[model samples]
Target: MAQGQSDPSCRRSPPPGGRSLRQRYSGDHLQRILLVRGLLKLLLVVAVLAGATAAGWQPATAWWAARNRPKFDTLAAEQGDVIEVINSTGTIEPVQSVQVGAFVSGPIVGLHADFNGEVKEGDLLAEIDPRTYRAVVARDKAALAARRAELERGAARLQQARREEDRSNALAERNVASISESDLDQAHFTRVGMEAEIVMAEAAIEQAEANLDTSEANLGYTKILAPVAGIIIDRKVELGQTLAAQFQTPELFVIAPDMRREMRIFASVDEADIGQIRLAQESGKSVQFSVDAYPGEVFEGKIAQIRLASTTTQNVVTYPVVLSTPNPELKLLPGMTAEISFQVDRRDGVIKVPNAALRFYPVRDHVREADRVILDGTALEADDQARGESPSASAKAEAEGERKRRHVWVVEADGLLRGIPVTSGIGDHRATEIVSGDVEPGQRLVVGVAPKDD
Candidate 1:
């Protein structure tokens, strides 16, 4: 027998109605191979399916990201002019404010004006009780008449005394009277006394006239009138209210000069931003503002004045900035708080990129590898070394080098990211001024990255 041949006694025979041992073994082996092959084919199919699903998911995910990724509208930075700086804030105020008050103590008899009442100069706003002033005027007039009558009588007595004194002196001179009789007969003393009486009467008349004039003034004060053309903002006096002017002039009303013209805004600029503020006449910075009352509406104004006086609150010093705004429709009211922004700087007709482009950081190894690839492909070794320098140092070097040294990633026409070098200038938190770059206006700039799904 062959070395590997199986003995018939050693091999187990098949049971009745069953296949032979060799046949059974062969069948079992074939079944196992088939099972294994089927299992391998199933595994291959499963792997292929998994790979296809992964490949299909990649583009969907990329498309979803491309569609949903944050997009920024780019602006062009040109050689056009830009304001260097601006800073300010303030409340709206009327150009002129007046406090209408009473000049005399009296009871208010009538109120002719109230809050929001429009008034002109010399308009009667209120009237006070005039009874007491009227009585004073009448009394002073009577006293003045009495004093004038006394003055006339004294003048007549003075004339009579002068005549009598002349007659007595003539008698003494003719020896018809003794020396004592001449002294006693002399009417000069009586004449002087009468003249003095006339002087006192004149003085009394003058005093009465003064009193009458004062009473007249008090009577005039009974009518409270507007001193300026304005609208009434406040009315403190009421009808039949007694006011005492002895201590202070009781306020009757408060008026603002104009509501249709320009208004002043008082805003405090932080110390950090104060350097930017200047007179509107000088800087010509246009300002826009909004208040809580009108959230979506923007109000326009010009910088009027920058006050030198600085106010310190909680140890933070700020300068007051005044802005003049028109209120043709009277939409802005006094005391409304405003949030203001001064257009300090702008670059036009130049390449502008999203601020995030300048801020984005690539992997350190990736940046080095990209630089190596660029240098290896280029013959200009000196230029490539210069380009490979740190951004800050390069920025300080030649201006063009500063512009051409920095790079940002842009999705290429082939759906792959590529590096584009650029030079950047002034930027707000939202956008950056691109000094030099291949980027164009209206091109989309990536602002953020989407997180990879697990």
Candidate 2:
């Protein structure tokens, strides 16, 4: 028997149904069974891989998030003063100012004072030409003298009239002269006419004297005098300038009273902030200000007056607040712009944090639900819902009346952020006072998330 030939027992003959046994169990049927087994093994391997991935998805994602998170910028709570200030702008002016003007009109002949000249009260500031006034005075004096002479002449005539009347009356009584001659003499020597002429002459003399006195006063007025002791900030008249008093009095000099002694600031406080200003004229709160002329140099003053009348510009209403300060060195000038601030409140030796800390919010991935601390309100109940809990009814009621609740984050020893809710008292733009909180001085606080690199 050949090696390749099969035994007669192994080689099956055709069956009675006309199909051989070898054909019934062919290679194609075995190949189909092997393929089905291979498919089952591949499905089992895929199921194992899916199970492994499901078991590690959470930790893998957590690790990735930890590595890719943004680092935060931090600030430490400090112990210092926090002052709340109300800001405003104003102009510096002298406490007292006067405008010197000419009372009499004449051509200016002499200038005794110039710009920036110091003067005292009753000091001669300028002189006007007195020729016209002097001429009027001379004319009035001559007229007065002429009127006095007229009075003397009238007095002599009155005396003659009186003597004549007496003689006529005596003649009538004696009966030595005719009655018609006596009557004619009495009519010619009427006493009322002589007395009337004397009165008229006296009236003319009085009028002439009054006119002369007026002319003398006008001549005296030609010398202009300083009304107040001050420094002349402005001189408007020239040596040859002619002033006219027919209309309004033209200003010749502007004097600032005691420029080296004191100064005043007129600040325009908004209507909304006027209520915050206290009456400080009689030793109330003090205010601080700075001028552009002297940078970084602060000057202090007190409120002198708060005008009740409001001024409206572009529909914005403001009130004038007067502040006075001493300027002994004369460093401040009139009309210089000053930036002012009123300290409304201040706190010292309190734990304070940057305003950025109070306003900082972490990204969604960085928020840890287990680390939230709600201090003084039930407003966090919505946030608690994620933890499968709801706030109590008492907490909800208390939240309605609770003072504002603010929070800041502190870094833990394990390099994780934890929130600390605090009771805030006072605040400014840069810092806020922490009245009650778990934080203390010298603690690092998360102010803001670090900016990303470009």
Best by TM-score: 2
Per-model TM-score on C-alpha atoms: 0.67, 0.76
Tens digits of per-residue lDDT for model 1, 344-454? 766665556665666554433333444545434443655757777654555557645544456666544543345666877656555666777777766554444545444
| Segments in model 2 whose C-alpha atoms lie over 4 Å from true places | 1-63, 170-189, 279-283, 361-365, 370-405, 411-419
lDDT of model 2, residue 428 = 79
Give Cα distance to truth, residue 272, candidate 1, Å.
3.2
| RMSD in angstroms between candidate 1 and the native structure over all alpha carbons | 10.5
Q: How much lDDT does each candidate structure score?
A: 0.75, 0.83
TM-score of 1: 0.67
The residue pairs found clashing in candidate 1 are: 76-350, 77-350, 78-348, 78-350, 89-267, 90-266, 90-267, 91-266, 403-423
